[model samples]
Target: MADDFNSQRATLSCFEENKPVFDSFKVNIGKGGLGHGLGEVEFAHSPLEPLKQEGDNKAPIGVFTLDAVFGYEEDIKIKMPYLYATKDLICVDDSESSFYNQILKTPKVMPKSFEEMRRDDAQYELGIVVGHNKEQIRKAGSCIFLHVESSEDAPTAGCTSMKLEDIQKIVSWLDKSKNPILIQITKSQKDEVLKLYPMLKLEE
Candidate 1:
């Protein structure tokens, strides 16, 4: 565990390669200052190709800050910020839109090329916003999130997806004070991260 990981919780998803589906696990660092495994979790990504532009169906590779626990149900208890996703919720991905890569709050109308957070498939029933191209870089990527997987074998359109139960456990355990982060580095990049954050461990 890194000393700099002041947070009480973190989710580490390691990839042997950017193969779309990878082994993932969560860590809970309590007052004792030691990490305990929450359990094993699996995530899916797009198989089309490596993540690049919008709609590539590939997940981005890098460390990302987790923001906003959102779901259709308003009763989900979490220590972090929460938003009850409604039909009005939209994640604008349009390159021309000034709000690219950001979720609009209570929009009266949907923006062009935006994802409806509230969907009939229930995939967005519970999710966390992933900070990939979050600075609103036009067409870099958008609507990245950690949400419910459509199927165990199916891949995501770019975001990371997992079992609903697994996601609920991870989200409910998150603590805002700890500033939990999601590390999505490839196996090759693992060595570099270890050199910088010696206390951190990347599992394959």
Candidate 2:
């Protein structure tokens, strides 16, 4: 097991130079859970306030894809996060509302983009591209990206949030030759990613 772990770690380590393939991955986090470099994508970026199909604060979970990109006007061909932004996107809910609890597509503009809904929170102004397809993960919730937060006073509606510069760095790094996709997440979840990937193991 130790040898296997080490080998895995080495393989992933090699990916480090690969540019954009995240060094680690997972789905979990808590308050004060933050990281600078790439990491495991979390199930929920901001679970403090969820969309109201009536009224409920439920964070999304489960495996998903790193689909298309957003925000950036000009498309810069990269491995992943091709011009994606936290402007608008997320796996809609399942309860099936006229609007709530459903995977929505981009340009859901005017009709309350992710930024407007979380305006009160600091993570707004950012948008996430929903990764999960109801048919794929079969999970009961949504999954999306994390980019440009509104600020630091509150949590996101359920999407992750990062800085514009970091987003640009991340986008540029992601190339098909490497990770091919970008996964957003926090610390608590990063541990689990270490266990699954082994390549993320640390000496300390």
Best by lDDT: 1
Assess candidate 1 and give its lDDT.
0.62
lDDT (Cα, tens digit) per residue for candidate 2, span 1-204: 111100111111113533334543222221222222212344333455222121122223333345545554444565655443333434334334344334345443323322222234433233345453334332233434455645433334344454555455555654544434333222334555556556544422
lDDT of all predictions, in order shown? 0.62, 0.37
Q: What TM-score fits each model?
A: 0.73, 0.47
Model 1 TM-score?
0.73
* Candidate 1: tens digits of C-alpha lDDT, residues 1-204: 222212333345533233223345443322222211111112233453233467655455556677788899967767988878888888888878887788877555556788888999978899988766756766777777888877764546666666788788678767777766666544444565676556654554
lDDT value, candidate 2, whole model: 0.37
| lDDT score of residue 153 within candidate 2 | 32
